[model samples]
Target: MVDFIVGKYNYWIYIVLMMIGFYAMIGKKNLIKKIIGMNIFQTAIILFYVSIGCKKGATLPILGHAHGHAGQAIQTSAYINPLPHVLMLTAIVVMVATLGVALAIGIMIYLKYNTLEEDEILKAVK
Candidate 1:
């Protein structure tokens, strides 16, 4: 039972992290906390993607044919899928950009209201 659980545990961890991030975002009253939650949420997603991309005994997909002349050789074996890694890289960039924007907006809000509390900002806006 332990082995079985261990074999397929990444999904469970991903779900738990996702839920924690969601709860933090919803339950926190501070802008910084919400941002942290967002970061956690993004990290959880990245983790899920990376976990899914992993192959049990595959090597990085680096084509040796690029540097030398090789007759077309058909080889069928395990090779790491580069798509997920590329997608994750793009996702990381987008997440960082999003976080930067969120932080900038939060800073603007703080400057306007002199507080980082969501409730206080809402009250002040009213």
Candidate 2:
């Protein structure tokens, strides 16, 4: 149990970060705070994916001279699996675009309502 927990500390840390972000998104009344929380949540997920994609002895999946041997059989296991990293890169781009759009909308809301709080906006709306 101890070994398992100790070995997977990165997962535990990210989980805590994810939960904190989740709470901030759900519990905060300010639109800016919620946006920040969402960004944090997305960042945590990206970090988690990146962390899991790494291997201790793995090199990049480049096509040249793996393991100091040119013109030799390339071992697949020697290279890192880059799918998760690639997917996370795309996710990061999407996350940034989403954040920009969300913030723009939030700014529009504040402009119209003169406030950024969810409760205040709702009260103003109705």
Candidate 3:
């Protein structure tokens, strides 16, 4: 069963990392730890995108028609999906934005209660 599952999808490593990051984010109570978890999650997403863009047998996506060097038009048959790359790029940008905002909020929360613990902050708030 393990071999069959591994053979079906070679990207299990990325999936595992993503799950770890998700688990950290959910399991941590400290705001800083949560942010680190978020960063890990984002990195896992980037890795997943890069893995998806990998093809078993394909040339780089660079066209070279200007220098009279005509080998064969880059094979389009084995080209990996570019959509994942593009989406990952957008997701990375969004992750940065979210991190920035989260940091700002964390700092504000710290200032208000002088604590990094979520439970402490809630207790102080109440």
- What lDDT score belongs to each candidate, Candidate 1 first? 0.87, 0.91, 0.82
Cα-based RMSD of candidate 2: 2.1
lDDT of 3 by residue, 1-126 (tens): 988787646468777877888987999899999999889888888987877787767655454464665755555655666777888889999999999999999999998899999889889889
Candidate 1 regions with alpha-carbon error over 4 angstroms: 1-4, 64-76
- Score residue 84 of candidate 1 by CA lDDT: 85
The C-alpha RMSD of each candidate to the native structure, in angstroms, is 2.1, 2.1, 2.6
lDDT score of residue 120 within candidate 3: 90
Q: Which stretches of candidate 2 lie over 4 Å from their true place?
A: 63-70
For candidate 3, which ten residues in a row score worst on lDDT? 58-67
lDDT by residue for model 1 (61-112), tens: 6766655636666343556777888899999999899999999999999999
User: TM-scores across all candidates?
Assistant: 0.86, 0.90, 0.79
- Write down the lDDT that model 3 would get: 0.82
Write the residue-wise lDDT of candidate 2 on 1-126 in tens digits: 999999988899899989889998999999999999999999899989988888879888676644578758778788888899899989999999999999999999999999999999999999
How high is the lDDT of residue 77 in model 1?
54
Summing lDDT over every window of 10 consecutive residues in candidate 2, give the lowest-scoring window.
Answer: 62-71
Clashes of 3: 0
lDDT of 2 at 39: 92
Candidate 1 vs 2: which has more lDDT: 2
